[model samples]
Target: MKYLIVGLGNIGAEYADTRHNIGFNVLDALAGASNIAFTTDRYGAVAELRHKGRTLVLLKPSTYMNLSGKAVRYWLDREKIERENLLVVVDDIALPFGTLRMRTRGSAGGHNGLKSICELLGTEDYARIRFGIGGDFARGQQVDYVLGQWTEEERRLLPDRLKVFGDAILSFACVGAERTMNLFNKK
Candidate 1:
């Protein structure tokens, strides 16, 4: 089977290591562990990796966070991957930091990346991995917090958290999202 695993984030030095870029971080870790490198492609930086018998195409969209759907749609059509085989990795502020949630379908939950994707895709019937960045900011500082760098404590916990995110993705490809969700969502 083939899967298009897209990690949503803005591409630039300014956005690097921010809480909002956790999706990119997860893909980078996964690619590094698989000994693969991404090449700049039509709508994103893309790399291919295999786990067991499945082919996974990893993408870090260059379309920026709010316009991510264009990149996703392009790649999905080009790769001929089924809608069910698409999984988007995105950061969510709703859950506590380091929390992971995999859902088969849902609303955007106030995320522009997801909103654009759903708008372009014309449906919410797709899978997504929402990595929690947590809502730890002051009442009016949401933007700053989301775009801010990780705290020293968050940095210490990141490697292990990213590893689990990588594993959850692999599990989703090999065992299916439901099983992966059951396994990882308990943590």
Candidate 2:
């Protein structure tokens, strides 16, 4: 079986470590833990990993955040992967920081990258792992905050939180959505 694991984040150093890059960070943790390095693939940088009998194709889209659908669709089509087997990891400003949420299908909730994938795929039926970035911005500071990095205090707790998310993603690939949700929902 094949799975397309997409990490959504903007390209360039300017976007690194921003809340928007949480997806990238989660993917990074997975790569490190498994010792699978991502080399540039057809549509993005990809790493093929086999953990616990499951094969995973980790992809960090080169299309940037807004147009992530382009890379995602390309990989999905080329690999002949089903929509259900495609799991997208993206940061969510709607959920509180350090909280991770997994869903089978839902609207983008104002997430442009997810919105683009929904539009390009013509559906939101695929799975998504939403890494919470917290929403505490005043008035119209939402953009600035999402594109910014976590505070020092938040950074201190990064490892524990990211581990849970990483394990949840692995569970999603190893088990199924229901089991993954059950395992990480309380984490």
Candidate 3:
């Protein structure tokens, strides 16, 4: 079995460890735990892993946030993986911090990264794991908030959150979107 895991984030030192880049951070932690490293390739950094006789293709899109779909599309086609087998990890400001929501299909909820992917894929039927970054910003500061660094308290709590995200990714591959969603989408 083959599965494609796409973590949406901008590629740069400036974006590292920021709220919008939590997707990248989760994938990085997943890669570390799997003892694999990502190599720069066409569209993004790619890592391959095998678990329970399944081959997993992990991608961290270098196309930035708004253009993430380009990398996702390229990798999916190149890997010959079906859209249903793809799982996107992204930050969500709608829920409280440390909250996780997994969905089989849905709208982007105003997320440019998800919007790009949905547009390029021509549908919103793929699976995605949304990591809540919490809406804790002043009025009209949404952009700065999403792009901003995590607070000291959040940073301290991030490792555990990333571990959960990584486990959710593995569960999605080991089981399926429905089962994984049931297993990980805790309030």
> RMSD, each candidate, Å?
0.6, 1.0, 0.8
- Please give, for residues 1-187, the per-residue lDDT of candidate 3 as tens digits: 8999998889889898789998899999999999999999999999998988889999999999999999999999999999989999999999999899999999999999999999999999999999999999999999999999999999999999999999999999999999898889974
Tens-place lDDT digits, model 1, residues 17-60: 89999999999999999999999989899999999999999999
What TM-score does candidate 1 reach? 0.99
Worst 10 residues of 1 by lDDT: 178-187
* Per-residue lDDT of model 2, residues 1-187, tens digit only: 7888999998789998899999889998999988889998776889988878888889999888888998999999988888988899999888888898999999988898999999999998999999888998998998999998799988998888888888888898889888888888777
Residue runs of model 1 more than 4 Å from their true location after superposition: none
TM-score ranking from best candidate downward: 1, 3, 2
Q: Which residues of candidate 2, in runs, are more than 4 Å off?
A: none
TM-score pick, better of 1 and 2 = 1
Candidate 3: lDDT of 104?
A: 95
* C-alpha lDDT values of all predictions: 0.95, 0.89, 0.93
